[model samples]
Target: MNPRNNRQVRLRSRPNGIPQAEHFEIAQVPVEPLAPGQVLVRNEWLSVEPAMRGWVNAVANYSEPVAIGAVMRAFAAGRIVESTMPEWPVGTAVTGMFGWQDFAAIEPAAIQRRIVDEDLPISTALGVLGINGITAHYGLLEVGHPRAGETVVVSTAAGAVGSCVGQIAKLRGCRTVGITGGETKRRMCIDRFGYDAAVDYKAPDFEQRLAEALPGGVDVYFDNTAGAISDAVLARLNVGARVVICGTASVANWDPPPLGPRVERHLLTRRARMQGFVIFDHPEHTPIALEDLAGWVRAGRLHYVEEVLEGIDSAPDAIAGLYRGENLGKRLIRLA
Candidate 1:
């Protein structure tokens, strides 16, 4: 393959707040010849996630920040077009951390999962059947275990992970409440995602609405945005409630961490358990989660929406759009 044919989005600078187009630079490079045991894949879909904000920031977090001038880190799904490895034959669909590039020449070890289930669109490998679904499954079921008739509140309720979490919690017989921004997304949380109640966090009476939504107090809080929204949810936690810190979408920067109401009092008063969830920690459960999620999707029990941006140039703006709440469900970039 010609080097000029390979296009990549590189991290030009560390973001101070939410990332902008100026933080990234697109470059055309020559594709390197495959090393022994390496496969060359042409990406079909690239996932744009809220966690990306942390990935590009200068501050340290669960994972190392993407170094300056490196290809932007991302989870992508594609088909192997050329291979020196016998195991990864040409045309095998795969999902992996291939960064923001059109083609990736990587060892088999870099591939996270081979995309089977030809019955579904290959892009589902980056959405419902991928990290988003897996994160929702383990985070809610294993961590925020909800019981029948219990109230389960999820922040960022209309997003990729939160939407799945709400639906899964409902399947478990729990009453679900979703907190999102704007009326459109709030309505989507109830009408599309099947949440029992939805509250607009941007409303003037958000606290009141949240209280009304969960009159019984929150039994399980799937905390995705750890800002003022979390503060309200923490205050409403019932005794022994479980709080799963999945993602921090609301907080702009974490380096000089934003100050907020102390959570010690809330946790102590409610005797609640707040745990952080990292999907990579439980790799063994991925297959189990995918099995159940795929089944639900086939049965029409699970519903998902995707906002797709065509071509690699759209990636930088897509990231900014996500922070602006411009997407309704899963946000993806279609490369092919």
Candidate 2:
């Protein structure tokens, strides 16, 4: 591999609110020859997730954020261009936390999962069959256990995690409703992902519409967005309901952490359980979730969409777009 062939998106500055292009710097990095047990990968797809927001910030969440001047952290899919590792042959595909780069010199241990099923698009490994799928599966089943006929409402309803949550809930025979930004997303949620219904938060009477949509009262709330949308859903929780506090996409950019209506009253009134969990806590449960998720995909019960942007230079903007609700589904950057 030529040293000058590598390209990466580096963090130029810490973001104040939503990140802009000035915050990122695309540089053509030099890749050294691989070590005895290393591999050089040609990245094909990079997953743009809300979690990337926390990664770029200095915030100490479940993991440490990317430091200034470092390559912006991201999960990507790539093909092995050169390898000394026996397990990973050249031209083999893989998914891992390879960051915002077109070419990566990584050890075999750094490869999270090898792409084996040739029929499925390699991009799916970064989304429906990747971290997003695991997040939705574990967050819902491990946290928001949906019983048959229970209502499950997901925030960020048409996104990667939210879409997987809805499809999985529907597969479990639960009545599923999605809360998304626009009518188009809402329609996509129902028509494409098998969500029983969807509520458009951009509508004038969103709260009333949400109420009308889930009349049975939400039994399992997959709380992805944690501001007003969460407040509305919390208020409608049934007794003994379970709430999975996933990402707070709705409030990711709030500096003062925009005032949220107290939902403790609803918790007490309904005696519902609201638990916040980072999916990594249950690493052993990933395969359990993936097994079922893959089966669902094979059974035609799961549908996925990806909004792919090309090049590593586009990664920063692609990530920022997730916060702005510009992405229709799982936002990814295609490098190859």
Top TM-score prediction, candidate number: 1
Error of 1 at 152 (Å): 0.3
Lowest lDDT 10-residue stretch of candidate 2: 52-61
lDDT for position 206 in model 1: 96
Each candidate: how many clashes? 3, 0
TM-score of every candidate: 0.97, 0.96
Kindly list the per-residue Cα lDDT of model 1 for residues 1-336, writing each as its tens digit. Answer: 463388999999888989999999999898888888899999989999888888888876789999999999999999999999788899999999999999999999999999999899988888889999999999999999889989999999999999999999999999999999999999999899999999999999999999888889999999899999999989999999999999988888776779889999888999999999799889999999999999999999999999899999998777889989899899999975
Q: What is the lDDT of candidate 1?
A: 0.92
Model 2 TM-score, all chains together: 0.96
Cα-based lDDT at residue 18, candidate 2: 62
Any runs in candidate 2 off by more than 4 Å, and if so which? 1-4
Error of 1 at 14 (Å): 1.5
Worst 10-residue lDDT window for candidate 1 reads 1-10
